[model samples]
Target: MDIFTGLINGFDIALSGTNILFCFLGAVIGTAIGVLPGLGPAATIALLLPITYIIGSPVTAVIMMAGIFYGAMYGGSTTSILLNLPGEAASVVTCIDGYQMAKKGRAGAALGIAAIGSFVAGTVAVLGLTFFAPPLAEFALDFGPPEYFALTTLGLLLAVALSGGSIVKGLIVLVSGLLFAMVGLDPISGKIRFTFGSIGLQGGFDFVTMAMGVFGLGEILYNLESAMKTEIVTTKLGKVFPTLKDWSDSKWPIIRGSVIGFFIGIIPGGGAVISSLASYAIERKYSRHPEEFGNGAIQGVAGPESANNAASSSSFIPLLTLGIPGNAAIAMIFAALMIQGITPGPFLVAEHPDVFWGVIASMYIGNVMLLILNLPMVGLWVQMLRVPYGILAPVIVLFTTVGVYSTQNQVFDVYSMLFFAALGYGMRKLDFDPAPLPLAFVLGPLLERSLRQSLLISGGDLTIFVTRPISGTLIAVLVLLIVGQTVFFLKGRARA
Candidate 1:
């Protein structure tokens, strides 16, 4: 009952005119980026972070950013279905069946299922957030430095565990990300480690610049190198609304995906991407026509789309409740929240119920807004597929350059972005995954800070890490994962 009352009050606050306008703006911008290839939510949010300073209210800024994050999730599928391009990693699964469905003239069905599934998942996940976030925040408040370190270690290991191929390559990329993160100022000594004597290097790599170079410019370069092109197949405007039969097929996948994705997302790792892939794998295994996978399987689109949205919603649990961002997008939101003089944690819910619950309530509203926005606009998004890369490539580069330059108003950052763009292109050509690198970059500084803090608290005694049950258990699990992977690889090599 208290939760119900709180949620109602949140609705009142979120629906206010100013906040509502920001929500609309965020959705519109996010959808625009999602429909376009290359640019993603992380880059968009990072580019917009500086603008939050002008907005002057942390709650409003964070709310708007949240709207963009989820809105991009809604929008990313549009390109996947219409152009065979995934605007974001979470939408990659959408391309397998989504693009195929388009080729088979089932574009309407794929788009409809994606939007409906996302709507259902986003709504349910918000309910999960409203109820679960406060309690988790409370639990996190009790964590010490050692516990935090252990949790981060588990997260990194899970990242390695979930890496699709070549654990060695994943670890290498993860280490590279950590090294790149270390290029900034030293957290403890305030000493510069990798500045290379350049004043510009003092600030280290900007997240926005790195993401834009790797995702946006890198994608453009890759597409340019390939002669392959995307054609928008004519889609018969069948029922935009999903049928009962569609519901029957998708119901269990949605529920299962929501449950699976929500929990994975709360774990403070690559939860969104992991959940999407996991949902697709599960749906494929349980599907009546498993062979239909990668060939416009409705279950393929339904399960992953739901899982990704649910994961996106649940990833907020850690950020809003514990001030620990699970990913880059959430990290940007954290920066926005901090600028508002609000420290997100268990006490935040009690201290600022309006902020917390208002954001929660707005998610519900945002989901509805996205569904309404996506349905009537399906034809328009499909039209976007027709945009020629010859024209689009230069526009992407322009946005990338402008967005990176806007971060610090420095030409140096733009140069760094172009450098990363070339690096990203090289890595993609080498079959290296860029995903793990960003996770490592994001987590590296936190890992260093936590380690140092734990040492200080324990008087430099490493035993403190193992003395705590939860932390110790997590460390042990990481070790087991590492060893398990090694053993599996050895066996495979021996068999070969």
Candidate 2:
């Protein structure tokens, strides 16, 4: 079907009472969670995964999940403006100018412009997703085992390169995750690989449990080591609307940010944080008064806020079109679809049109809901910051435990979650990133299967990956990424 017809059908599904209600709920819940520092969209989605099962339809569940992803992004700027706290990692840059604006009694304007900018960027991203994703999916229909293997290889490499850490560390974590994923059984032979005489190991590790442990409980544990405090700006929030001058100054930055964020988000490991940082740097460089950046510049807030939200929305493209999630949050969303027995891939648009279009349509509705909700309910979001971490941490732990136990009424699942939680905590202490591990774990099976299948197709000839046009191009890209990262890593070390 054409884009227009597909969107029309999607609206038909998204406009239903159930889908709309869940979308709104997701947005509200996501915004609330985002107001709490360190609880990013990925952790929020992981914490809420079990609840998706109760939502009934796969499309409905996904509509809600998608709402949570981008909705958190919309609300993340709140704490940044009010308390100079980044509720989401992507909101970190917003703190520089947003908090300064708040101190100068321009908090309301900073937040209002952020909401407006986010809405505009989100709309742009949705339009891109509507038109761009389907054609990309159609193109992916040509992929075979060799192509898939090469693509996944490139994806894994890109994940490491963009991890914002040492490439060697990212690879270490990724390989560890692959080993973890090898437990249970070999896919082709159906022979148990590492069960070690335990029935609980028979099903392999549950993605939901692992995700909740690492992102939900582990994050809370990591944060507990640091003192959590909030000194909220109590200045009477001025008019909750940007002045004409604010809009005039911010218009171009928002547009530029939207375009930049959309493309960056399509790359593996590229998401809100990176997009926001890049947008801020770009805006600062282009600004007539570059020196005004860290003070009360409205462009600083508008640009990064818009970019992060735009990136969040466009990050869905790779997952829907290529069955590849670019980051941890998208990976969890992929897991959510798998829980519903709906696989995401190039054929997803053709096979599960309702899910694809329903999610896209819900984004339009969710953005409107966020804009309306954020401006009017800024006070409520601020109140969320007042809840003590002492009270919040245990509640998060309890909820994670309950969710894991409810999965199959099995104690083993809970134990596995606790195990990963401890492991996740240790990894954090060692300055290692836990993001790539779960993502690698999730992608390991697909990578292995593709590798095995490609070998069989080529009669054990490993050259098949570099022989095909698409596959060869992908492998070449992977090699370039490795070389580039190695050179960069060496240069930094030499300078150090």
Candidate 3:
């Protein structure tokens, strides 16, 4: 089969000594970060983004970062099971039952199921990427500015729709993210909007800084406030492998999660998080003992863990094929690609088959590595929780400081990170979701660029957006989603 040959070529690239070493290093470091509380893959990648500059080739840099992405997804579940703390957003559902399982002396089985499910999901998702990416890229080539604009709009609407709780709040956060993205230079006129005369402000706030602030520092601050009274679950080393019953119960959830995650991941914005949450919700809704949820259900750990990893893999499709990043981690990869003078788009598959297929192959290798590393080393990961907070806190702060500064070797980034940290902490206190902010910021520039280009091509005619069938259909779906949310909200209020 042609697909088989391409996979062989991919393996040839991934198995090379140089790539293998980097892949292993990425997995090791990613797992380390995943075991630690308060740090997520986005922050870890942001911290390492500067390393790509020294590493040279964008292909290698991206491959390594991709390792970190999936590796962390694999590692985060360890923390969720052992400590009741999720190292990343996607692992939150894992904590619902993973920690409880630990308390009930099934930590090993919970962790094993997570590892196995992630492996299956990740492998299938990469295969999907390998066979489907080129054709998707070809299709995207037919898109015009209007289509892109419509697509971005649809992405934003989807993000809002999936935001859960208070659609108004979700929209507000989404708009705020869009506004934050507008702080930099105007692409059309080369004029600044929100810089306000500060030289540092002219370049705009880095999304990395904002993400670290919101997810990392804010998490630390919240935990610190309650650290004194928090109960830590202790795990008993039981069977390190899943039982026949565990396998039977989890097989369907793993399959369902992978399918759901892959499709959601291709949808442009907040797909990974949404897929994970949706998978967990689905698993719970369909489980025979729904009441056992949040009290050590193995399906909870298996389903969301599978979804998160699958979603991480599928998120790459948009980035590699269309130059559109589906999430923050993918956006950072885009920046690395641009830094290497490599353009990602329709021609990427033909222009750089090695980079394209090689990365895909590396994922397969990385997934296997993660499964091996996560299972046998469960005890080592659990030991990480025993590390003293006083010692760990400073290390995290140091990494955050260095990573932000490394972005452009500017101390201002450090201050910007601190400022956002405070802002993030406040937002958390107010129950304001920060998810939409990064999504909006990343998509804002592209949205503006496409809108202007579409208008230019249409001589100021707005009908250009509706003329394209795909674009029109996407717009209609967005409108329907907004109306549906509104109706649901009004109905709920009326009942109350």
Worst 10 residues of 2 by lDDT: 228-237
lDDT of 2 by residue, 1-496 (tens): 8889999999999999999999999899878877788788888899999997887699998888898999888889998888888888889999999999999999999999999999999999999999999999999999999999898878877887887887778999899888888889888999997888999998799899889988888888898899887665475678889899998999998998899899988998888889999999999998999999999999999999999999999999999999998889999999999999988999999999999998999999999999998998898888878788888899899999999999899889999999988988888889888888778888999999999999999999999999899999999998888888879878988999
Judge candidate 3 at residue 404 and give its lDDT: 75
Q: Candidates 1 and 3: which is better by TM-score?
A: 3
Report clash pairs, candidate 3.
Answer: none
Ranking by lDDT: 2, 3, 1
After best superposition, candidate 3 residue 324: deviation in angstroms?
3.0
Regions of model 2 farther than 4 Å from truth: none
**Count of backbone collisions in candidate 3:** 0
Model 1: how far residue 233 lies from native, Å = 3.3
RMSD of each: 3.1, 1.1, 2.8
lDDT of 3 by residue, 1-496 (tens): 2557767887898888888988888888788777776667776776676677778866688789889888888888887888787877788888888888888889899999999999999998998898889788889888888988988788776766775656777788888888888887787898988988888988777777776666667656665665532234456868879999999989999999999988888777656678889999999898889998888888888888899889999989988887777666676676667657787777777787777888899999999999899999878876766677767667777877887788789998889888877877777788887666676777788888999999999999998888789888878888897888889989989999
What does candidate 1's lDDT look like per residue over 96-148, in tens digits? 99888778777778889889988889888998999998778778778877887
- Over 4 Å off in model 1, which ranges? 1-6, 82-87, 95-106, 227-229, 288-297, 335-355
lDDT of 1: 0.80
